[model samples]
Target chain A: MKKKWLIGVLLMVLVMSVSGCKKDDQVVLNVYNWGDYIDESIFDTFEEETGIKVNYETYATNEEMYTKIKNGGSNYDIAIPSDYMIEKMIKEDMLEPLNMDSIPNFANIDDQFKDLAFDPQNKYSIPYFWGTVGIIYNTDLIEEEIDSWDALWNPKYAGMFTMVDSQRDSIMVALKKLGYSMNTKSVAELEEAKALLIEQKPLVLAYVGDNVKDMLISGEAAMAVVWSGEASTVIQEYDNFKYALPKEGSNKWFDNIVIPKGSEHVAEAHQFIDFLCRGDIGFLNADYVGYATCNTETMELLDPALMGTTYAYPDKALLENFEVFLDPGDFISEYDRVWTEIKAN
Target chain B: MLKKLSSGPYWLWSFIFIVVPIMLIIAFSFSVPGEAFKFSLDNYKRFMEPVYLKVLARSVKIAVEATLICLAVGYPMAMILARMHLKYRTIAVMLLVVPMWMNFLLRTYAWMTILNKNGILNHILSFFGLPQMTFLYSEGAVLLGMVYNFLPFMVLPIYTVLTKMDNSLIEAAEDLGANRRTVFRKVTFPLSLPGVLSGVSMVFMPAVSTFVISDLLYGGQYMLVGNLIQQQFLVVNDWHFGSAISMLLMVMILITMSIMNRLGQDGVEQGGGNIW
Candidate 1:
């Protein structure tokens, strides 16, 4: 009787501790990725075709995803991160290299997307989507041509602007505005950028991320420092919206897919990446997510409006002026401290 | 000896989970701070920045204000329930507790649908010919979210102690021509202080360290202690300073706890209502 009573108490504690909203519980294939970075239908299609119950989870920022992936004790099967993160993960040896022979459909990816800077020689990661950092604007709200970086800090547009809410992007803007390289390694340039940001902070309505799309479309903002892919999405919904690579310079970036080390189902993970990279699937994914697809065939299926939009696919001259964000390593803490100081101020 | 063995398990838990983590944090705090390694004590020195101090001060102010409101609202509600007959009292307390059945994150997120610019509260305000207020990303929203999440914890402890009061003592006070206010001041209120201390401890610590609700509802517009620690460990990739901040927060909480314990006589000499 005592043993039965003890078992009953334990079960009650389990029940009380549980939140109990999970119903899609079979053998779960957990795929973790950055927020709004994947096509939902691809997961559904994978489920229907392969009969694997895919559990899709999202993280708002790269750091958040890393925190869970680090502390979760190797349970995640598949993860996606930006290029710099892929480099760091490889250095930490936290990822297992993909077996390229198992993923033949990866051939659909354009040659330009392959063997990129973050993973020279292409050992650990596969490129997902590539974009350039630039100015996304409300063309109707501004009367002047915005072919230069000065258009962002114009006094006439005070309280009418937004910018990326991060040390890297915001500081890069100041660096470029001052005619310096976007990836300025000089501490003097960074300090100058910090001062420039302090000047611009009051003019900012809010430092926002995901809300930029809704706010820009609704006319709450006239311009924002935005990702090219996000700029593409918002531009499709409103004619007045447009984006450009500042005449000075900008950052070029690509997100990549990789398997975290100690993945239990490496085969399924590679299969998923391969399946999504096929021409039709890649096209659908690009169309739905409103990002530039890396596949050459998928590029043809893109909406002509999106195809012709200079912001989505910048002219070669503009693309040439872009620099990739290198992993700043130990300097990251200083970057964080400076950012916290800015926010607190 | 059984006494030493009995203390051993608790000591082990404290050392492993609590003390060791705090020590690790302190060590990280003293590292020759760089982006990566070759550590120093710069993070602690860096903590002297006015912005960090402002964030710390704001977190404390908000936590203290929430604790007072929880106490003021909780004390009366707990007393009334305590005065109720046994059958009705049980049902009343359970109703207050049923809202906790929902997931904490889900409950906090639900507040967004009610307080956002286009949310239900504004919709009702428009219908009533009142001006709509954007409440979602403000400091008030953070307080309301914390209070809602933690009120029950405050209520239950106070209620448990209030219910244990002998009716005869109140009757005795009234027989001496003392009015209800005097009876409460002289007899009931002083006696219920133990429950208030327990309730305060339960509510204040969690409110100060709240991680998710404030971020979701306020859209990360405000920085509290938890968000600061989160930024350090995750975004900045600086676990050393992050650990130091954790240690600092722990020390602050310990100091507060000691002060509270002194006020409540360690809540031991004060009688506890039976929970088991």
Candidate 2:
């Protein structure tokens, strides 16, 4: 009996070793992206069209995606990170320069998104989705014209409003209200922003993340500071809701897809990127996610109702005032310190 | 030799998964960010600031409150379960274990739905002509989350100890003409002290180190030591300071467990009996 049991165990070990060394007849592309950012059916369509299996994973934030890739434990062929993080990764020599020739669909992207600060010359990244941070307020509860950041601080709306809990976004709101750059390195300016946040804490119903959309939809709060894409979705569901871009302006952000330095399947990654840039695919994703697509071809295909929406296509006058958050470089620690103080207090 | 060989897999597993990770954490705790690993004390020094200290103090305060609340609620329930007949006790224990089978995140999400301003709790209150209660993002909400999640940890250990307790001691106290209250205080409570200590440690350890409960229930406004460490590592990418905070939290928990162990030993001696 003992000999038979030992033979069974040895057979199992041999089988496992054999399976581990099986020959790869098909290409596999590992893609990591933000959670709920893509339409799920796109994966199946891509796999079927290209005959390449996709190993898809998701992260909640750009920083989280960076840490996983930087640690070198997991290798993903493609990652979607925001502009500031993409800048940080490029500086750290953690991204590979894209071979633009392989991505002919790159021509479909709007020229306005090209040659941006994070990856000037489009050397290492392609813009995925671009949106602005704004306020979503209930028309029923809010009687005034909500066009400025000052509405968030009004004591009349005390305990009736929510703000995004992200460190950069939350701090950016205060900085814009104070007539300071969101990326200001001046300690005095940052201290002023920090104090404004501390004062606003009592009036904030909660400092939430994506739950701002939920809070607004459920009528739990009179107003919520939210992203343009999420705000558009909430507006569709609730007729009483309206999204406004404060006249002082807000952070205009872009998320882009790029290949990390050590990714093994560069060719397949390029194929995946080019496929996503197709006008139909881009339109499908943009419409499904309620976000603005960077592909100019996709823009023409978008529904007229969506094109007319202010959140997705803000006025040119309003657009002129938006600022993208720059890479803070060594000053990031200072911002983190201020954020920690705000939360701890 | 055969027995030693039989335990070889366990030793290797612990060495690889447990010992190696801890060694790396200690190495990271003393290293500087954005530099090659080397011995430095900057990470620990950074934590000495009053801002970080206040976070630590608040974490300890809230954890202590949750642990005490657990003991107050759990001890009586455990005692009642222990004293019940076999069939009824089994049904009661089953009811307690049912919630544990669900994922903890799902359970926390349920609380979120119930406590929000337009949630079921407030909806019911307003239906009865009462005012709405906004309790979603408060310290009380955080405490509620901790207690709801960790109460089972407090109950199971005490219940096991009480079930295994010797009945002869109680009979002896009764035969000596002692009343029910005297018997409970003199015999049962003293003998159960070890269980109480273990339960407190179990509850306190997780309560003090949790980030998700507070982040979700309190709307990410409040910062605990756990949240501080998480933000350092994940958000700010400052693993050095995160590692140092982790080490400090580990040492703090170790000291607390040692004190509880000493008390348990004293309880054993005073009761003139040994707990399994």
Candidate 3:
């Protein structure tokens, strides 16, 4: 009689657990974005405004995020990846086209951030944050006004500055210095860029990633090739550091949000993206992440002190020198080989 | 029939987790990217290039150096611990192991702070009117990290062997007119050979394949074979080449292990299966 009672309880528990595996009625939107790229409180606010649950995830790099999404087991509803990756994903049909009717707040995005080369019609992605790559230097270390990429290669600054560790960013510096497009496909142009980088490798104190900001602030490296957003953060904190866009030009980047092709909660994903695009929410995110926002409404709400700052928001003429990174497609192998060879050497 | 039924789960687990993944890796290694089901030696051919060969050579060299350093430092530590009183031995062993309880990356990051240009080490140097050094982002820093992390692996196995060694054999050698140095040289060192061999392999394997230590310490200025394979899969999205590199690394490790096993066999026979 006791054995029968225990068996009955076990059967009941198993049934309950099995039923628990079934999907709940509440919608959950899975969002994958770069690490520390959002104002996390916005998620709670979003959940309050809409009943959809926000399941947030983060990745450290575009390549890492792309590899995960490309492998396809992760059924993320929305992802925020940079321009070139969005272009690649769209080409591969990994992205679902945005329904303009669903995303009404996208109209608040600035005109300059729209119809970018990656998304010519702005169909698949909405601009999340945009910034350019530039040099952030310690003014206290060098007296002369720094304006060009050649300062990185100067013998005087050897072992005093860091180059970005990223393949595209590092190669872009060399290509721009050589007066070639960052997205150059010609083997000769790439070879020249490779040679330039190899020559400059010894002078570089280190090849660093996002930690370049900390290194610069700590005065480990007197100068670093960094994204404008990171530079702006350091410039705001320190009196000695200054940001400069070199005369030879540099790459501009945009991180944009898009719904992945296999999203189960398409409507909730649209609602979340629209929520993020709202002016006050955009302002909160931009303020927290310290990146330039695409929403013009958010721009007006920004701190007046940061307006027209070289690192934060440069003038239109200075912006003309920046080129957006385009998807190199299969030609990226050349870049990988070149980068590996450089590091190996 | 009962035993077979009991072992069924083990067989299933191995088949699903170990056998299947290896088969997949082998299949991927033989194939070319963008061309499905087409087998090619192109990935292996690419790895043979001088740039990649140098990376492999550098990785082996660093691993060897780290292993040697561990052996040098750990052998003494093991001896000291083996000779300690029971009450103190436990405390000493725990001291060696306590830092390992912390996350490996966190420990490595702590080293970065100590070795940075304006870090604790530099502050001490400046305080004493000494020149500050750029100790981080160099090959030396990476080596230091490998040795610091893997030293316990080298010590623990050797310590177990030394502690388990028969005291009668050493006493017998002493009675046969052998001095302290001669007794240790003959009995202690030879019996400890199996432990030493296992320790070398344990330290060498992880040191060679560790990407995180070199990534954080050298700041990606230095490339190793592990980093190359990581770049192929994660950055370049070329699983074929990555798998090929992984297969090569596994083969290299197997070859080293077999060589060590051959050396350890004679010691194991003499030491009575305390190889650890």
Candidate 4:
């Protein structure tokens, strides 16, 4: 009786395994992006319109996405990584150059965003969203206007503010406050930044990430160093919270979509990129994600209230203070060591 | 022949899942990043730096503290559970295990909400006119998280050992004019040492290697060895150094386990024979 039962189970397993392998003629395009980055409704719309199945995934950081793609087992066709990471991937030859003819919507991108440092010829990546890093503070907590990064180190506000947990962002705050370039490669400059951070460590309530938003909303902190996108969402929801672009300047960043080398569905990946670039689609994503859109048509479609706000869309003069993050290449280890030392201390 | 054939799948599973991955990690630990098949000890040398060693020492310190706390609290609870009425024993054990069925990360996240500055604990404290304290983002909070999560591992093994203990032995000591305390000191505790050893290893192993607990509870300020390794591999893209740290952690754990095993054997010898 046991033998017969075992045979029956084995046959059932064989049948189930075979059925699992069965696939329809539809092509599946695996699109990996930041967690909570896009409108979920767009997936259904894209699938319905194109008949290309969307296998969507999310990663929390650019490094995580880069590691997974570089490791080479995952079959992800498209990934959205930041400017520095895109540059690193291109230098490593891990990205496939885009065929611009396949994506006519490339013309929709603003000329200012195009031919930038990361991909000068716009070969490997397409601009998705761009924003700056700044401080989001509650007006009721601090009486004075916060126009400088030095406000972070004020002993009066000790234990009332948080810094970004990221290595580059936190180091940039220290460097900018000291009047050094945010992308300084000098060992002495980095050591000085490290010393500043270590000195400020006692005053910091915490070094936090995405949960900074929740902390601020609950009044756990008076201020936090945050990406402009996160600040925009919090500012729109809360009446008292305001974002400041410190006069000492800060990091401007862009997250762009790129196809990893050896993607099985390149054609479908280009199609998805084109679909994402449509004005209506870009508007939906930009509005949903609370990040500045790169598409000119999407800019025209944005809410007038948001456009009028300098923090969300800074004017030309204000833009000059922001510098795009450059890939440090081999010098990133110095950053790693400095950050480790600060955290260890 | 049939028995050997039946065990074939087990050996194959171990080879594919366990043995190969370990070999890969060992290989990576000894190699240089960005250079193919070039062997070097630079990764190990880098880990010998003071900053990384301090991280290692902190991880060990916290793990030891958490283990001791678990033992202090869990031992008496286990003894009580073992001595309880059979009817109550089931309910008590169920209560201990029910919370563990929920996700580990979820339980840690729940602590964040309770310990936040404006969270439930502070609210209660303020309601009673007590000053609000910062409970989250401290070494204490991280230690509390570790003890809370791993307490069950400490309790269950000791409970099993206590319950399975020979009642006749205790009765004989009583009949021979030995008091309860004398009997427990001379007999019961020695026999339960094996369970204690296993429990210590179980709790200490995970506590030492945990990154998430420190990351969430201490707000990235507290750097543990686990977090150091995670940062190297994920953020720094330096797998060689990460692998070296992981290998060192593995060696430390192995040494600890072997020491515990030796102690357990000595306990068994003192108790007159192996009880398990």
Reference contacts preserved by each model:
0.36, 0.93, 0.93, 0.93
For every candidate, what is the interface RMSD in angstroms?
A: 3.0, 0.8, 0.8, 0.6
What's the lDDT for all of these models? 0.78, 0.90, 0.91, 0.91
Chain A fold similarity by TM-score, each prediction: 0.91, 0.95, 0.95, 0.95
DockQ of each: 0.27, 0.87, 0.88, 0.85
Every model's TM-score = 0.80, 0.96, 0.96, 0.96
**Candidate 4 residue-wise lDDT, B134-214, digit = tens:** 999999999999999999999998988899899998999899999989999988888788778878888999999999999
Q: Between the candidate structures 1 and 3, which one is better when assessed by lDDT? A: 3
Give the C-alpha lDDT of model 4: 0.91
lDDT of 3 by residue, B50-122 (tens): 9999999999999999999999999999999999999999999999999999999899999999999999999
lDDT of 1 at B249: 85
Candidate 4 stretches with Cα past 4 Å from truth are A1-23, B270-276
Question: What are the per-residue Cα lDDT tens digits for candidate 4 across A1-345?
Answer: 775899899999999988866655789999999999999899899999999989989999999998999898888899999998999999999998899999999889998888889998899999999999988999998889888888888999999999998899999999998989988999999999999999999999988888999999999999999998999999999889988888888999999999999899999999999999999999999989999999999999998888846557877676677888888988999999999999999
Any runs in candidate 3 off by more than 4 Å, and if so which?
A1-18, B270-276
Q: Candidate 3 residues A1-345, lDDT tens each?
A: 775898799999999998876646888889999888999999899888898888999998899999998888989999999999999999999999889999999999998899998998899999999988988899999878888999999999999999988899999999999989998999899889989999998899998886888888788889999988898888888989889989899988999999999999888899999999999999999999998999999999999888888788887678666788989998999999999989998
lDDT of 1: 0.78
Q: Which ten residues in a row have the lowest lDDT in candidate 2 chain A?
A: A19-28
Q: Residue A136 lDDT in model 1?
A: 84
Q: Cα deviation in Å at residue A37, candidate 4?
A: 0.5
Q: Assign candidate 3 its CAPRI class.
A: high
